[model samples]
Target chain A: MQRSNIYILVFSAVMTVLIGGAMSLTSVLLKPAQDKQVELDTKKKILGAVMDISTFDKPEEILNLYKARVKSVVVDIEGEIIATDDKGNPLIAEKVNAQKNHKIDREERLYPIYMILNELDPNVVEAYVFPMFGLGLWDWISGYVALESDLNTVKGVAFDHKGETPGLGARITEEKVRNRYKENKKIFSDAGNLESITMVKGEGITGLSMHEVDGLSGATITAKGVNKMLKEYLGCYQSFILNTRGLNGIAIN
Target chain B: MSAEATVVEKELKVEKKSAEPFLSKRRKNIVTDPLSDDNPITIQVLGICSALAVTVKLEPTLVMSIAVVFVIVFANLIISLMRNLIPGRIRIIVQLAVVATLVTLVSEFLKAYSYDMYKVLGAYVGLIITNCIVMGRLEAFAMANKPYDSILDGLGSGFGYAWIILTVAFFRELLGSGSIFDFKIFEAIGWATFPTNGLMVDSIGAFVVLGILIWIQRSKSGYVEH
Candidate 1:
């Protein structure tokens, strides 16, 4: 063939080799940093949901705040707390070290997290922490919420969603939606019962029991899924919520 | 000798006539054209995939648009500079190599410096490689034009795509969140302390945005013509 044909074939081979080399190098080089980012982000999501952290400038600050305010432990099926790793893996008592090994599933280990606000805040009272998880329109919606001792009043709440539409059902990430769980709170009924937060189908939730909130009308399925998850998942810690409520009610009254 | 001379004259005239003034004014054309008469996304419709995703939020869309502008302009300039040396058969592979390398670097910077916006953008940053605008500028005007001209073409096309996207996203986020750039612009009734904000934070919010954008773009620009 002509000179152009020969040159083209050789140049094609050279480019192919270069691109293949770059892709492999990128994967290997970015592995550690990428993994760290993912882990850090996940921790931030969990803590941000439960912690009173509005603006902490650094990751170190976030980690420090989590260390100081949030205490985590493995629990048994019957509300027994275990300081040791539930399934026998050990790195530290409370810290998660993804670098060394993987921790067992939360179900197998029964992980419970408690996050506290400022101890000096005079309004602060008995904190209630519960794990909530459920099916969403597309995937699982899960997170933790902290409420005041009153049980009807919200202290703070955080939520994380998977596979939801951006700017739609995913608006759950916005402060307005997530923070809506604050004050004038509703986690129980006038009957003094724990009914999962329900999506009111009619005329939006107005003066309904603390057990209901007006969910997104068009995205009701996702809202209902979140309701179910928060209810079912928090049910595992029922004895804790009830036992504390019983004790607090007697003392406060 | 007479017949040979005649044939040569005819060949020259045919080449000059068919090529138009465009082929001859290369030196001047290099400095301009992409500004309007040769615009990319509007006139060319190259990149829309990112426009659809990033425009939902203005801040992320701003970052994304800039990153694309940098990649496209530089990719075009670099590709055009090496155009002559590139083997004709392997040109596309070379084009993609340069584009992919740039995209990966931007993705890394985003992950490191602006994780929040990066989260908002998600995989769309990596999807820059597939943005037809970049490749189109590289192949069509960049390859044949001078380095300076290719850069302008890149910028012009990028602006075209960026403005259209921001317009769409501005309306989308404004109507959807009742917020701009995550700041509450409107608070829903009976939901806040001030009663000043209008709350559009419902599922209908997103649909309202999609409807307005589709209607606006289609009706005014003669786009989505049926």
Candidate 2:
């Protein structure tokens, strides 16, 4: 039996209302939890740069650990602290998603620095984590790089990308790749001078010095992208880091 | 056959079910056939994309399987309930809406509760809307069946799909990462010298494993193509 046009219209109209209502209600109800999940993920990435987050760990434990060890500071391109609004609260670093801010002007952008502290003294800063973003062979690549108190050597790094080729360029997220950045010199020469690290092709050869690490073999373009990203992001943080060296009681030439 | 008749008999008086045995033979068949003879992945060959994509890890594949089971069962029940009222012309649209809504619900719930697993599954959860198995069951079985029988059919088909992908993931994660459920099984056994197969981590590995699985299943069951 052929259904009449009126029946089709009524059925479709009812389904639209029912499905739309159900979906929107679910979305509204789950928004808070979803938002919290996103926040935790960002924190996990930031914390991941400095320490290992076990897959089995609970959110509260991770959040407590992050709160205890990490301090977020927002700065401008000129390395000046960007003061908070009328209220007397500090700006949250995770809120400043660097990838989204990448398209904006440097002066208007908020640069977040995650300070990793030592075990004994919270005042004694162990490393500074700067978020970096750049183009990969296919899409955007973003990550965190932790700098030693000297602000020249890399303590550790963690990278995540979108749409990179699987098993090739996507290997940037692998622990082995990110581990290569640990203790390697990111800035060369003087304290104030900003010489970003270079990712050279090939490995196991002699003379792999400060400011260089072996790149992924088949992912030349992605390796180059990582090199360029480090230079650009680290350069943005140079002046602030240089000025803060003395405040932290670190002797500089 | 009597169990099928009983289900059809109970269809009209859904509210007045006569305390039928929980596992009628037809209902049992509905849930069990897909485990082997009617397997959705190997036999029917539905939902191959997700089976390949998420099976790279055992944990995520298991999560995806549970998500699918929840979706298919609920969708089957809902569609079966509304089957009679639905206009034939707009039936497909209604099915799509139901599946999409269910998928979105599952996606939102995952994001809220299992953030880590949610990240691993990523867009694939949303892509569940497109998994042919869900729609295929809705149209072929649920649309003509009673709610109770449709639920069993959905469960059966879902498990059939789950076992196949879970099996594939077992091999993939073990060989690909030298791990099971993120535990370094190979290292724990002191086989640190064993070289992990890089190929197993890729999509090609999923295809190869599933291809062999299909061959084995078909051969044992004596299934022949038309």
Candidate 3:
């Protein structure tokens, strides 16, 4: 009934080692699959910004579709493409961790842009998707905003978050909520200034203007976070947008 | 000669007890008591936080329930097996270490196999380590019971917790979203105009639904508080 102090110490030591070892082994074994899931999820979000991917059940189908329709490029804050990192590793746009990039200085961040191409005509660009990351009320909120080839009209938007309050700020992930941005909201004004889309105060408000979308009712802080995220990230991508527009022979104001 | 005969008779009785049926009445009670009379969430009032948090929708709640069941069952069995070797002084720590390892395994498995469910469940999966029901069962039943009995107790308590949360989720999802498991019931049945109650989607709705559930379950089971 009575265990000596040494006996107790040895028991606990052994228990700690056994459990820790087993857990680490399982984690290492599962790491590849977990990484693949994360990669697929990010790709799905990027693709979800421009098209409905609900029907794509298999991972291969999604990957193939991405391969066929999507092209990516990593550009610096000044709009110049960076093909590789300083270590000579190829910088793939989909591989860029937006959350990590969000922590870096604005001037030094590498932004990824996914260009959706017309299926029948590869030469015709369809939509451009930009990844946006920022602070939500309780944690980080991120999203993808796809712009029509004209580089002004919003094609679609998909938002995601970590640790946001359910039924409130978490509604940002809902299709109905994301549709607010996709409802013909423009990111630029006629003068070519990057106005960015804004989520106005209060929910269920109709008659939204060209650059305005209704905000979540009880999540003013998160709504503000989304607004600021869009404005800031879009501003960061303004140079790239202008350059691409110019390349397409569209006059830049 | 008489004393030797009595000893033989006692040995026969002991053999009979060991050979008792697997699903004997007493063991069955251990697996059934928590379902109604000794419900973990309603009667015992343990693990109510997750009962409220994850019940906003049915799918995530179902996943949470399964994860909790897996954690509790294994934790109980392991603790019971090590009951004798575990020092009384450090038993709680040992129990915690076992439970934490199991929970981590469950989360990792979920992350690998069911990424969408993992994302939806999110931190709630990690919070299973903190759910008092798992710890309560280990401390109350597993630490002193046989391994088989501990497992049954875990099943009883797990199912007890699962059903309660699932019930809460059913109503919340139905009323909040006009759907079951994200399928729009109203839209499918030609009643697309059914307006969902926003309150049901919030945590307060969970509280309301659980309160009503507890009330109904207790009244039916005739469980009275002192």
**Highest DockQ against the true fold, candidate:** 3
**Roughly what TM-score does model 2 have, to 2 decimal places?**
0.85
Off by over 4 Å in 1: A1-17, A20-47, A50-52, A58-61, A86-109, A121-128, A131-141, A150-154, A188-194, A199-208, A217-221, A239-253, B1-38, B74-104, B139-149, B167-226
* Per-residue C-alpha lDDT of model 1 across residues A1-253, encoded as one tens digit per residue: 2247768777778766876787668767877777667657755765666555668777888877655555555454456665666476642423543212113443444546464545566334446565556667877666667766665456666666656665556656667667666636666656656665665653345675555665664567777777776776556665566655676663322
Among these predicted structures, which one has the highest TM-score?
A: 3
Candidate 3, residue B122: the lDDT equals 74
The chain A TM-scores for the candidates, taken one by one, are 0.71, 0.83, 0.93
Model 2 segments beyond 4 Å from truth? A85-90, A134-141, A161-172, A183-229, A245-253, B1-22
Candidate 3, residues A149-217, lDDT tens digits: the string is: 989999999888887776788889888988877878888887878889889899778888899999898
* Candidate with more favorable, higher DockQ: 1 or 3: 3
In Å, residue B202's CA in model 1 sits off its true spot by 9.7
> How many clashes show up per model?
9, 0, 0
Q: What are the per-residue Cα lDDT tens digits for candidate 1 across B1-226?
A: 9999999999999997666654347534443444334444444545655666566667887999899988998999989898887866667878988999889878876776676666676667888999988988888877887787687677777776677667666766675545678777666444334332133334343345545655654465565433
The positional error of residue A101 in candidate 3, measured at the CA in angstroms, is 2.0
> For all the candidates, what are their Cα RMSDs to the real structure?
7.1, 5.0, 1.9
Sort candidate 1 into its docking category.
acceptable
**A-chain TM-score in candidate 3?**
0.93
- Model 3, residue A183: C-alpha shift (Å): 0.9
- Cα deviation at B60, candidate 2, in Å, is 0.8
